[model samples]
Target: MPFLTSPVLPEGTLSRRPQPDIPAAAGLLLRPWRPEDAPAVHAAFQDPVLHQWHVRSSESEEEAAGWIEGWRSEWARECDAQWAVVHADTGELRGRAALREIRLRDGVAEVAYWTVARARGQGVARHATDALVRWAFQEIGFNRLELMHATANEASCRVATKTGFAVEGTRRRALLHPDGWHDMHLHARLRGD
Candidate 1:
C-alpha cells in the first residue's frame, strides 16, 4: 500500500529553533530561558491563581530549572519553543509563552502562556502572546495556530481574543485538574486571519 507524501516546505523554513530575542509592544521582550531564571519561575508558579488555572506548581528552584531545561530539549528536537517574557528596561521575568504541539507536516501549533502574580493586571500575557503568534506565522511558517484555556479562565480568554485568536468551540470536560474536570475553550487564528 502507498502512503501520501507530506507537502514540502520552502527551504530554510525554521529548520532550527530561532534564537533571536523578540521585542514586543509595552516594553516586553521574549527571549530564551536561562538557568538563572529558575528562581523567578519558581516564585511565579507559587501564585495561587496560577495553580488554580494551571494545576501545577514548582516546589523548588531545582524543579523550575528542570522545566527550563526541558524547553531547551524540546527546541533541539524541533517540537516546541518556550520563551521567558521579560521587561526590557529592568530585565525582570514577568512570565512565559510557548508554542507546543508543533506539527511541521501540518503547519500547525498551539500557544500557551502564564503571567506572574506581579505581572497580573498588566498586558504582559497579551503582548508576549501576540509577539509569539506573529513569529510562528511569519518566521516559522505555520499556517495555523491555536490557543486553548479553561472555559472559566476569563483572563486567558481576554488574552486569546486580544491576540486575534477567535473562539472556535468548547471541549467538554477535556482537562483534568486537582479540583475536577474542566471544560476548555478552543481558540484559533489562521495564517492570514
Candidate 2:
C-alpha cells in the first residue's frame, strides 16, 4: 500500500496555509524553506549518499528553484509544512526536513523527514524531527504521531529509534520503492503511549 494511496490523505490537510516564521532549533533550528536556498540545496542533492536514501529523483538548479517556490506557495496555502535544516549558531541552511501527511483524527498526526547526505548522522534529522514532533504534539495538540521507513533504509531505522519512535511492526510490501514493492518498518510515538 503506497502511502499515496493510503486513506490517511483523506484525513490530512489537502491545502496550504500561511507560512510560519520558524527559527532554527533553540540549539539547532529547522526553519522554513526559502528561494535563496536553491543553490546549496541543488548542490546537496548531488551527494550520492542522499540519493541512496531518498526516494525522489535528483534535482537540477531549475528544479531546486522550482521546488523552493512550490514549498513557499504550499506554505502560504497551508497544504504542506516544509522546513530547512540550519545551524542554530550560524543560521546556515544545512539541509531540508519535513513533517507530512498530517491527519487530524482523534488528536493524532504522522510525521516524516530527510536531511542532506552531508548532514546525516550529525543529529540534524533528529533535531528537525524533534521540532516537528513537539509542534504536532504540543502546539498542534496531536496526541499520537507515526513514522514508517523502508526496511532497507537502515539510517532511517536508526533515526526513528534515536528520536524515540517505537518499532511498531513490519508491513510486508507496504511501499512502492523505485525498484518495486518493498517491506516497511512501522514506528510510532504517541502522546502518552
Candidate 3:
C-alpha cells in the first residue's frame, strides 16, 4: 500500500495548540518529557531487551538529552505530542507514549509506546495505551486511533487485543526491521463507534 500521508498532520499538527500533561493510568503517569528525565530515559533504553524489542538505536546519556530537546521543541510548538511514563510510587521513569501520524481530516491518530522490561507484565503499557486513547478521543477530539505491531511481537498483539484494538489486517513486508522487511499486524480503535 502507498504511504498514508496527510497534509493535516504536517502543516498544523502541533501549531500553537495547548497540550496539557495528562495522567495515563492509576499506577503510572504520562506527562511531557522533561530535561531532567533524560538520564533516566537513557538508562531505561540502555537495556538490551528494550532495544531488541523496539529495534531502536542505542543512545548515550548525551544522546538521550538531545532527543529530549526534540520532544521539548515539539511540545512547545504543538507539533508532535510525546509523554514519559513514571511510576506513581517510586517516580521511576518506566517508558514512553506518543501520538504520531495525527490527521485531523479523518479525526484519527496513530499511538505508539514502549516500556522497560522490568516494567513489563505489570500492565504499565496497557494502562498508558488505554488512557492515551481515552484522552485522544475525549479531549483531543480524535475519532480513531491505530497501532501497528510486528508479527513476532506477541506481547504487543496481546495488549492491542486486550485494549479493544481490532486486528484490521496485515501488511506483508511493510516494515524494514534491523534484519529485513517484515510483516506488520495493524490494529485500530474508533471513537464512540
Q: Please report the candidate that would top lDDT against the real structure.
A: 1
C-alpha RMSD values across all candidates: 1.8, 5.4, 4.1
Q: Please provide TM-scores, in order, for all candidate models, with all chains considered together.
A: 0.94, 0.80, 0.86
- Among all windows of 10 consecutive residues in model 2, the one with the lowest summed lDDT is 8-17
The list of candidate 2 runs beyond 4 A from truth reads 1-18, 21-26
Q: Pick the TM-score winner.
A: 1
Off by over 4 Å in 1: 1-5, 8-18
lDDT of 3 by residue, 45-134 (tens): 778766655666646888888888897777655445788888867778878888876666667678888887688888888999988888
* Candidate 3 Cα misplacement greater than 4 A, ranges: 1-17, 76-79
Task: List the global CA lDDT of all models.
Answer: 0.88, 0.70, 0.79
The true-versus-predicted C-alpha distance at residue 124 of model 2, in Å, is 1.1
Query: CA lDDT of 54 in candidate 2?
Result: 61
Residues 1-193 of candidate 1 have per-residue lDDT tens digits of: 6648753344234545356688998999999999999999999988989889987889999999999999867776667878999999989999999988877778888999999999888999999998998888887678889999999999999999989999999999999988999999999999999
